[model samples]
Target: MPTILDIFKDITKLQRCSGNHSEFIAYMQNLSQKLGYICLVDDVHNILCKKENSNAKIVFQSHYDIVCLKENCVPEIIEDEYSLSAKDSTLGADNGIGCSYMIALMYERFDGEFLFTSDEEIGLIGANGLNLPINANFMLNLDSEEEGEICIGCAGGVDIKAIFNNKKIVPNIDNLDLYEISISSLPGGHSGVDIDKNIPNAIKLLIQSIKGCDGKILDISGGERINSIPANAKAIIATKKQPKKLIDNMKIEKIDTKSEHLSIYDDTLLNYLYSFKNGVRELNKELNVVQDSINLALIKTNIDEIVIEFSARSMNNENLKNLKDSTKSDLEKIGCNVNTYGKYPAWNPDINSFTDTILNIYKNINSKASLRAIHAGLECAIFKEKFPNLKIASIGPTIKYPHSKKEIVYKDSINNVFEIVKIIAYNLK
Candidate 1:
């Protein structure tokens, strides 16, 4: 039998980024067959495996997809005494570690179902479109980042995109200088989990720096993933004079490049971006968690249009709806088209017998274990929606800086979590 670290190393070698998890799916299917477990795959490529003649029907769930920060990524493992990370890329330990836990359990012939979902990084796409026949009454979601905290609930989320048509114009002045303005080196983090930390968004900061500048926007682009706080942003502006206010961490360079067709937008766009409400909107004092929040996740200016993306989350469905409706109305007032998609319901906090069983097991191993309800979206919400009767609890190793290039997982935490999972599976009825 392979150890947890050995299985995790194998998982990192596969290309399992969002929308490109076919190879990983194949690998899981092959492994299930080799292990003599009955394997089943759904239309959305969610893999489910079960041992024959298993009386106890518990499901261990983990998504196979990860947020790929770099293109053509072959994850470079950087190991230390305590933890492991990747070189200039995300370690994919967000779900990889969870997948490894499930795989190791399968190798041990655990009497339960193993569920591998797809495209979880992109708003739980597989869970949203899941059509699998599930026989389990309880599910253990292995997607939470922090160890020793069993996640019983998570915030619901929706993707909001606003589009602005670019009004192209010919350059009227010949003496205009092309200056590249950039904001970099910001401590970007997970938009949902880190929104309340007051980290500055690079795109918002860049737009604020050039507020009253006498310049024409040539092009503006930044932000890689909608789920991450943008760390860098750059804009090419044709201006006769540089802006008065210079902010720190912003780089301004003068260039001699000239363009005949420059895309420009009115002050409405800037005002809209500035006026947008970001970060935590409300806190659930009762639950001690974030109740409502929004993230200005991405901004891109193309030849024809400027696209702005946001991720809005709320523990209450009405709050989530109101936030999205208000954002859409605000953008529509400014002549922008808005679209929202990838909406998933929230998983309400519940203290049931199943959760109590898992929590007790976790506490026996680590007496400091606690119950938590995260502000970020989790597939548990989707699972709850589909199987309202199914009891769900999420657990995982400590993963820091997920969805960014600095992601790392603690080796000790993985071993401890694996032990907890094994105990839960063995004692599960």
Candidate 2:
């Protein structure tokens, strides 16, 4: 049987980004057949594999899709003394390692169901649309990043998009100089997990640098993924007077040609971006976790409209609703049309015999095991909503900087987590 690390290495070769998981699905189907396990794909392309007759009534769930940071990201493993990472691209260890654990457990003839979800990186789309027939009474979500901690609950999230229909006017080519202002090299990370880190957002920085500049916005675009803090942004503006001071990690280049169409509502757009509520709004003191937060994720300019996207998360549904409504009202006040979607409910913390069993197994392997709830969104939330009676807990190895190119998984942590998982699977009845 292949080890977890070996399986993870193989998974890195497949292209499993959101909305592009067919290749990975085919690979899993073929592997399942080769391993003599019954495999099926749901309507949303979630792969479910089952062993014949097993007393273990547990489901191991992990998403197969990853956030694509670069084009054709062929992950190159970088090994140091203690961890493994990729070269200039996201390693996809967020859930790839989880998938490997399930595969390894199945290969070892562990009697359990393995659910490989799709499009989880984008907004938990696969878990949201999951209609698979699950027979297990307990669920083990292997998507948590911290080691030695059992995640019992996670924040719910909603995606909000605001569209501004701005009037455009022609710019004079002779009077204005076209300059491209760009911000790069910001340490981008998972929006929910790293929102409180005070890491500068590239889009926000770019807009802030040219806030009061004498310029007309020609085109502006930034951010790659909705779940990731933007690391790079660029704006084309027609300005005669350059801004006095440039922000760090930002560059301004003067171009010879001028832009054809420019948005006349630059002040409104800048004001909105500057006044947007971002980062952690509230923290749960008892749980020591973020209770409410928002990420100004993306900005794009089209011919007639500008679109801005924000991700809002909270542990309480009422808090999430209030934040969403307030944000929508704020955007609408500025003459922007707003819409919110991809809303998933939070999984309230619950500790029972099932979680105690897993916690005991983890403690047996590592003496420092603890139970905690996370600020980030997890598929466990979706599972809880769909199967309210099912017991659920999430565990995984230590992964650093997930959803970014600097993502790495501790070498020893993978082994430790796998051992704990195997023990839980074998003992669960």
Candidate 3:
């Protein structure tokens, strides 16, 4: 039997995300054969493995899908201890770490149900599909971020996609060209925690500058999901006439960002205007710690108007609010209409969780005790509603920068989280 870290590494090799996990699901079933545990797959591909005689039932939920594959997903052992690293692609640590953690428990003697669901990325389709028996009394969710903290509550989120009813923008032969205006290089991060970083929205700022330039608005594309901060966006504008004073005009004067010319802007003023709004630059003084953030989530445009979707989040709600408010106000001041939607409540943790029975076992093993809340979404709220009598606790080791290209789970955290689950499965009431 492979160790927890080894299992984690193996999982990284699977492509289990959204519409892409059927193969990985089969692989997980194959592993179950070694432990004499028959994996049951639901119509929706949710998998459950059960040990019948266990006194209490603790279900661990995780998704088998990854957001996407990096350019070259060559898995390599990092730090020599264990776990795999990939080039440019996401390591799928967001929930793959959770899957490996639960898999470890299912094989060995366990005191409860091991639940590994799918479709968590696109939506909570897998877990959302389950019809549980009344006997399922407890849940320990490992699909959380950070190392020591037990996730008690989570924000309920909805991913929004809006398309502008745009007519094709015909370029002006008099002076029409596909000019690319982009806000690049800002440290994009998880939409919830990093949203409050006061970082510039690339699509939003770009639209403002492009609009200010008053060249014919042609085609605009921006962000993808409401959950992610858009890092880079490109747009094309037609220029039958580029005024000289547009970028420096009174409208977008407050933006501290820059712009360039692909000969797309007829007005040199648009260049000077863009030169002012250098949007989305990294100001992280702590190197990789990511103390700052930006929301460049989406970009879209129509012949008449351009729309960019943006979300801002910070561990600090006050700061998050301030940044969001500022961005909205600034955009509107420049005549760009801004709207907000699909807002959810943030999940704050109770420092004193009664530790329940899980904490005692975690402590007995001398593992680090982590008590923190993160800026991500989970089913904690839904689970709490469905099983109000059940005591809920969530813990996972260092899965960082979820929902992005930089996603990775620390191999060491996988080991630590697996051990924690083992203790919970053994001692759950």
Better of 1 and 3 by TM-score: 1
Residue-pair clashes per candidate: 0, 0, 28
Candidate 3, residues 1-429: lDDT per residue as tens digits? 667766777777665656665777688678767675656788888777765454546677776766653332434434344545445445667777787777776666565666777766555666666664435667778777777766665544433233333243333445343344555544345675455455445555665657665654445565545556565555666543342322221122222222333223223323322443322323333222223233446656554544555544433345546656666666554545566654443344433333456666666664666454555566555566566666667888776666655665666666776777776666654
Lowest lDDT block of 10, candidate 2: 258-267
RMSD of 1: 1.9
Task: State the C-alpha lDDT per candidate.
Answer: 0.85, 0.86, 0.56
Flag regions of model 3 displaced more than 4 Å: 52-55, 69-84, 132-134, 166-178, 182-187, 197-201, 208-216, 239-296, 300-354, 361-370
Looking at candidate 2, what is the lDDT of residue 378?
93
Candidate 2 colliding pairs: none
Tell me the lDDT of model 2 at 358.
87
Candidate 1 structure quality by residue, lDDT tens digits, 159-212: 999998846576555657778899876767898888887878888877776665
lDDT of 2 by residue, 1-429 (tens): 788888999988898778887788888888888887888888888999986554559999999988877765767888788989988888889899999999998788777889999999888889988987788999999999999999999998999999988655765654777788988767789998788888778888777766757666677889878888998888887777785446678888889765555545546777778777678999999999999999988888887888899999999889999999999999998889999988989889999999999888888878999999998999998898888899999999999888888788998999988888888888885
Sliding window of 10 residues with minimal summed lDDT for model 3:
246-255
